[model samples]
Each structure stands twice: as structure tokens, then as C-alpha cells.
Target: MRFSQILRFHLSNNKWTAKQQYVPKHNPVLEEDIKRLQDFLMSKSNIVVLTGAGISTESGIPDYRSEGVGLYARTNHKPIQHMEFVRFANVRQRYWARNFVGWPSFSATEPNHTHHAVARFEREGRIQSVVTQNVDRLHTKAGSKNVIELHGSGYVVKCLSCEYRIDRHEFQDILNSLNPEFRDAPDMIRPDGDVEIPADYVANFRIPPCPECNGHLKPEIVFFGDNVPKSRVEQIAKMIYNSDGLLVLGSSLLVFSGYRMVLQTKDLNLPVAIVNIGETRADHLADLKLSAKCGDVLPKLFNFKK
Candidate 1:
């Protein structure tokens, strides 16, 4: 079913849901959790924060591995691998098609309470910097000062064969122009700005080339199985070394890239705090672990955003 002129697809009932809007619920245990987290924060300064999918789940973006409501749990769709995305024409075509459909809703997502809390904490001189595995770019939007996009952001598209780059907004317009018939089609949006289109209709999806040299254009995010850029890795390593401790928020730490951050902190004998609802790879190593909703716990613990 369509919503006005725009095509809308909802995953739950395989019907249509409302236009995207998100507001976090208040937690009953927030007060006690805040006090505990505050006490934990008191012992650390100049800390490094590592965040993941769990952080954005409250912002209406689904995560990949949450037990009841994650992408991996519900579907067989795998995130595109870097090599496949680069090597195959059909892969790029499909990716861009899904991205084009999902962009409006995904990019329209707002910063949630935990995002603002982290920004406030940074402003108040609590943490040194943020290193995130997410490609959403919501941290900077929430007013975080020092942020390292460990996996890059989905806001820019770059050519694989050239340095030609363009804002995703510009690319959206380009996509609409090239594929007018599909500019608004039935789309089921996902967390990473990819949508679910019918398998048969995908054959007709159009993909635009880089205006400069007709090179392949891909989002700036480091796709799974891709190595993080050397410079980005080096920078994060420096940030980790210059920190007082490590604070992990809303990550399952299943990915080695994110899990390694805490391991380095452990090697340095620094205190590590993990705030997540689910079990993490580093649970045994955490100096403090709080299983709570990030949106509910963070705003209460750090209200400097106002």
C-alpha cells in the first residue's frame, strides 16, 4: 500500500505503518541506574566511548543482533560485503536501489536521549572522544565535539575509481532524476538506510554512475569485511592511548573492530564500563556493566544538554 504519493511498506504486518517518528519511553528503573552510572563515571575522566547498533535502536533504527527485534534475527538478508559491493555491478545496483528508497526515512532519524547525553558529557569535559561502529552519523548531529566515525558515515557517496564525492542529498536528487518511475516505490526501510524491495522488481532498478568519470558510486561507510582505513585506525589508537579509561555504550561487542577497543583499555589497566541491555563479548572484562536502555539511563545520568 502507498501513503499518499509515496510508497510505504511496513515489516510487521507486511502492510503500511505511519511515517517515521520516534520517542523513547521512560524507564521505571532509570533513577537507580542513573545513580550507579554517575558513581561509575565519577572515577573516570578523559575516557573514550565506543558505541554500536544498540545505541541507535531507541532512535527507531533496528539493530542487527538484538534477540527479539534485530535484522539478523528476522531475515536472511545479509549486509553487503565490501568486496562484493566493489566487484559486482549487480551488487551496486541493488544496494543503490535499496538505499535510494530508504534514504528519506533513515536520514530523517533524530538524535535520541543517549546521543544528547553523550554530547553533553563531552561538552562537560567528561569524555575525550567518541569512536562509533555505526555509519548513521547521529553522534555529530547530537552535538558531539570530538567524534571518530570508525566505520564512516552514510551521508556521503564517493566513487570507487576516483575521488569524486557528493552529499547524499545531492545523490538523492540524482537518483530521482535517473529513475523517475521508481522515485517513489513500495519500500520497507531498514536501520542502515537500505530498504526491502520485491525481488522481481529489483531487476528493473536503475543505478546512476559518478558524473565525473562514470565510476561506481558507493556510500562512504566501511562495509562489513572491509578494513578500516589506516589513518582512521591510527587516530583511534592515539585516542585510546591518551584516555583515562574506556566507556562502552549500547554495543554487543560481537564485532572484533569494536571489541578490540576495550581490550586495549584492559591492556592499559584502565577501568572499562559497559552500558547495554544484552550480554557483550567484554562482559567478563568490564569494570562496570549496566543492563539498561541507553535513552532512559543516559539523559537521567547526564542532563547537561539543556
Candidate 2:
């Protein structure tokens, strides 16, 4: 099956089923569980939400870390680490080339139901803050006020040498001017906003430099090997410390940075509830684990007046 078809299939059918009596498959939010979660939220003055790539997958953004759906998987290559991309000039060229090709579709993506639901929760004061591992700025676009992007966003690319920032659109224009022959080239676009191109062609592609400083430009994100900024980490820690409880959405919590936050919530004796599809690393830590689609559960759960 094609990538788009596979995505549609997962979206249409993915859900959770109940094994116990008096429980429903489509409705993973049991009345008892809802009461527990609702009471938890009501008692708390502040509630924190930790989100991941899964939250944005519904908006047609792909999870670049997953087995079959990620950029590395599509190319049958190991993921390019942060250090490698930064150190190797050819790697940087390929990286930018892919970014140039896939920029349009990624830039065009809009926020989905889950994003809107979370944003609404924040707006209504149901959620105090959101810490996300995703690079997509859908949370902010959906109207969320206090969002901490653990990984950087795709919309902004920065120069490695001069630290100059350029919008993705502006960088695309530069790529077009430099490589006119590749303007109409066809390639498979990956979920992480990267394109699959021929290795030889990628090796020869010319990447643009910072117009003012002649520095190397790169996507502003926490690459695979890069650590999340300490200041951002401290900020999230403070948010978690201040919040009554932590609510996790659509994340597996596979990475240590996110998982550590969930662990901290548990250590603080705060309730941690999770809404996700598969088994997460923090499943054991979750006070209530709702194994269901976020789009289905979040709206009802965070709809304060209801």
C-alpha cells in the first residue's frame, strides 16, 4: 500500500477495545475513569499536558521515529544523527535538498481536532501549559498560549555559524534560485518534512549559505543526538512542579526527556493520566491509562462545562 493509503487506514480503524464487562470499545473513558480524571482536574489549580508527534499525526504530519512511517524507514537508512549532519558537509547538503523539496506540503499542513481540543483546554484554563516533543507548531497555531516545544520547529531554519534565522519559505526561495533544475523534481516526501532523493544527486546539490555571514544553515530542531536546551528543561520542570497533575497526549514517552517528566510527576505523588494508542514507556506510571485515540477522548475529557 502507498504511504497515504496506509495513513488513512490507520486513522480510520485505530482504537481500543475493552475486555471487561460493562465497558465499551469505542468509549475508553469509563464513567468511573472520567470521574477520577475530572475530579483530578477540578481539584487542581493548574494542569500540565505533555504532547508528542502522535498528536500531530492526525494533521497529516508523520512520526519520523516510528518504524515504518518515519523518514529513515522510507529511505531504508539509519536516521541521521545531529552530530553527523553538523559535521559532514555532504550530509548537510542532502539534508537541505530534502528540506527544499518537501517544504511545500509540510508548510501547508494545518492543525487537526486534537490540537484544537488541547488549545481550547488551555484557553479555557483547563490546562495550565503544554510541553511537546513535536516540532510542528500546531499547538500555537491552534491557539494554545503557553507551549514549550522540546524539539525545535520546522518553520524556522538557522545558520550554524552566524546564528541568523530565516523562515522556511524564504529559505525555499533561495533553494529554488540556486537549483532551478530540481524545482520540478519528483520525490517521496517523508513525515518529518524530508524528501527521499537519489544519493548521488544529493551529494552534488548546492546548499545556500547565510546571505550576510556565509554560514551554514540548518533546521532549528533538537536533532537525534542533541540535548534539549537546559533553560527549556528548567522551564518545563517548573511548570510540572507548579501544576496539580500531568496529562499526556498521544506520546509513547520513549525519549528520556519526556519520560523523565512523567517520572517526576509520579515521584511528586501527582496523578498522571495518559491518552495514547499503543503501549507507552510510562504506562506503568500512569494513574489512569486510556488506550484510545486522542481525537476521540480529549474533546470530551477537557470540555470543562460538560
CA-lDDT, candidates in order: 0.79, 0.75
lDDT of 2 by residue, 89-208 (tens): 988887777777767766766777778888887877888998989887888888888988888888899987886898888878888888877855443544333467878768767887
Top TM-score prediction, candidate number = 1
Query: How far in Å is the alpha carbon of 56 misplaced in model 2?
Result: 1.2
TM-scores for all predictions: 0.88, 0.83
Give each model's clash number. Answer: 0, 0
Q: Model 1 misses residue 172 by how many Å? A: 0.6
In model 2, state the lDDT of residue 212.
75
**Per-residue lDDT value at 107 in model 2:** 76
